[model samples]
Target: MQHYRDDFPILGREVYHRPLVYLDNAATTQKPRCVVEAMTAQYYETNANVHRGVHFLSQRATDLHEGAREAVRRFINARSTAEIVFTRGTTESLNLVASSFGEGFLKAGDEVILSTMEHHSNIVPWQLLRERKGIVLKVIPMDDRGVLDLDAYRALFTDRTRLVSCCHVSNVLGTINPVAEMARIAHDAGAYFLVDGAQSVPHFPVDVQALNCDFLVFSGHKIYGPTGIGVLYGKEALLDKMPPYQGGGEMIARVTFERTTYERLPFKFEAGTPDYVGTHGLAAALDYVSAIGMERIAAHEDDLTRHCMERLSCEIEGIRLFGEAPAKTSVVAFNVGHLHPMDLGTLLDRLGIAIRTGHHCAQPLMARCGVEGMARASFALYNTREEVDTFVDALRRVVRMF
Candidate 1:
């Protein structure tokens, strides 16, 4: 992990005249040099529109862009690249399913199940769909430890349940939901299952086939790749049935005054000019992680999580830590006694320690935990044990001042 640290030049830089100890990984990861160079080289050498041009540069750009899609397919172990639809990010991906799938399948009384710990991106889209299509939304409840009750989830599914969407890992709690088992349950009930893998893919290997999810969504920025680029992977059968998410030039097979037909599986979802350079960078990011191995990265982050939790609990008095699920990842959310998380986070930032504060785009999770917000310190593969120690020590000093 320490060897890999050099690949991120931002980690070597200082903040507020102190060494930066970045722990806001649940938000986004720092890009590796390889990813940056890949994007730069793509722009320098092959700057052209993809998919329609016959020129050499256009062909090269299209190849690289589609190659990045293949890279994503391999990374997630999807059956084919046809199942992969490039989107703006996880939000758009989820919205794609909500809109297209909603329009194609969902009816007025149809029900969709979600979880209490889902990010707002997952929640809001469905809510919007419910407003438009009159679909009903159900929630899977989690215990105080941030663990979703399997029995409750099992009981929530009715015959009318058309879809079940959940985050693979909670952004706030870091609880790794049993998505594979959940997918099995959803299938048994004849409902499509979608996994929001924004947090999971960067930390662990995600196989869409193995999970048996009908759809999977994740963002590039969360995985050491560029922003404004992500993926929506749906089973080809389902994608073939669903309508296009947006109407634009590339997604059309033929345009006419009276009628029009849509293109194939992925391009139907990808409406406009795709982010070719971002795709190249995303491929570089995925390739970088693949070379390192996801298992190794998971192990490294696990150690960092355990170390940070132990240190925080031992060093700080009356500190209430959240998300104590047995199956969890590197995020630790907590608040010191009688201390506002925003204030604590502000002070920590001055000490060159970066951590996320506030509701973390999961206000429902915050409300469920009975707090307005929590300070979250999330670890990444490039993080080190020493940085965790620094963050904990700085947090302690900040607590003492109160």
Candidate 2:
């Protein structure tokens, strides 16, 4: 792998007179200089409204905007650009699925299967579906190591199961889910599977066709792109069947006093003047990741995760690590004994060691683990082993203080 740190310019800066160690990647990643330059170049030279203007600048803007959609299509290996719809973020993407597809297919007594380790974004959408349509919500249990119980998940699917929505990776636990198997089980049971790829897409290469999921959603910010930009990939036929989530100019084919018709597959879901700058930035982010190679990024992050895990296990005492899955992502969720995660994070911040400390949008997982919250050190390709060592040292000092 190339020197991953070289791509992210912020890695060179010092904080608190110490080299900064940023491990809060699960929340959001720092943008590479390439991504920053792309956005800057767009605003400085080519800035125009997309898809509606007739001038040269408008054509340029439209091409860049649509090119981003194609980039997203290639990023996840979706069937076509028509299957990709832009949204605000993963939260909005999942909500779009729930509001459009969920409302169309789900009915009273229909069951929606979700796992216990899902983030609130995945959980709350199904809850909304249940409340509005009287649909049944079934939760698949997880093992002690934070891995989902495959047997339990399989048993949860039945003829009444309308859809199965689950996370590709648990944000809090770092457990990479068996989404391919889960998709197969859902399909065999005559149900559609939706993979929440907010965590997985950034950490690993994703081929949606290989996974055979009916839908996949991810946020741009988590992938080193701009915030407020996300992609939702749906099967063409499924998107055709689902009703529009919103109504506006871009998504309509013809509007009249008597009747109105919607546009084709993807635009039918995106119903307003979209986030043009954000999409351009997202395209640049994907380009940057592609240049770096996803496999190398994943390998780098895995190395960092293993290093942190080893340091915490062999070097630190009285630290209770959460999420012990054999195959995991870069996140290390844990807490030192008798120390609240917030306090640990505060001290670590003083030392220029950034980490996340909270429920991490996975309250159910925190409850299952019997902890109020955890201190999480999540990695990205831009992070380094030296940063992990610094984080470990800071953690040791925090443990000693209490």
Candidate 3:
């Protein structure tokens, strides 16, 4: 309900002699001042490695670092900090699960079910496991509207299906998947479920327990935090059963030439020096968003999404909008006439409008949609209806030239 236009300093910046209209939020959000200041303050005050030294600075830094872990646990409503493992980003988090979970639970003949709309992060890790461990990967089909074919998805699972992993919201389509039902379907088939919450986390309230997913991953940068930090949430029993993703000094309890033992719970998966400053930034970002409230943010974004869609549809003739699902988030994927997405995007940039154009790292989804690429204008809490007006007008200008 509140307008936070000034919270982000980057919005004041001009591009190509025009006011900046930043709509490429699905790629990465612009950081708030609080997030930037928090990371800066952490380095200036508490700059020491966690769980390593015994001195005052180390103890103080460790507390701040561990406090961040608790903040992330509370952000997603996770059961405990033990279930949250920090990684570089969503990609690394998914890779950790693929490498550790694959080694522990998957065998030669096991199957993993994924959706066609998954980002490359979710797809590549499983493909790597297939190549390394001989695991079979099946894709859940989606319709032209970018909605997943749920009936077909259910049929893809067999007794060999060891895991069912899908995105909570499609980064390209913006279709919010029915993950709770899908999780139940996987459970009925005796399979564990994982949800990629990268696109969903910043915009809405997400409860890992309510979804009944064994694992969930999301990136902090997408949620207005600093880059190179992500959270991986796994059920305690499952994470405890899986092996460590990488072996290093911090993750170890004892080291010997004969044998070495690993640390417990969260630390076991987080090897080497953790990003303490970035963790602080993430916590600050969560606090910033929470102050505004997720429900309010989601509602504002939904209104903006519909407004942008209506303007584009009514003003621009022959504008083909992708992802027309009844239930969707704030992304609008469209290609105007025969104008190539890249050409349209380049011209729009000259007008000081930023929009993502291409396959959006989901080549499979692009192929399924029967397009080489598309121009995506995604909204965030800080984005505005005025910026949306500027974007649509600029898009019209770009289309006229081509």
Measured against the true structure, the TM-scores of the candidates, in listed sequence, are 0.99, 0.98, 0.99
Estimate the lDDT of model 2: 0.91
List lDDT for all candidates, in order: 0.94, 0.91, 0.93
lDDT of 3 by residue, 27-70 (tens): 99999998998899889988988888999989998888899899
The best-first sequence of candidates by TM-score reads: 1, 3, 2
Identify the superior model by TM-score, candidate 1 or candidate 3: 1
Q: For candidate 1, give the lDDT of residue 15.
A: 95
Name the top TM-score candidate. 1
Better of 1 and 2 by lDDT: 1
Listed per candidate, the RMSD to the true structure in angstroms reads 0.6, 1.1, 0.9
Q: Which segments of candidate 3 are over 4 A away from where they belong?
A: none
How many Å off is the CA of 289 in candidate 1? 0.4
lDDT (Cα, tens digit) per residue for candidate 2, span 1-402: 437677788877888887888899999999988888898998988899899899999999999999999999999999899999999999999999999887788889999898899999998988988889899999889988998899988888778998999999889888999999999989989999999999999998999999999999999999999999999999999999999999988999999999999999788998888999899999999998898789988999999989999999888888888888988988999988788999999999989998999999889888888987899999998887888888998889888997
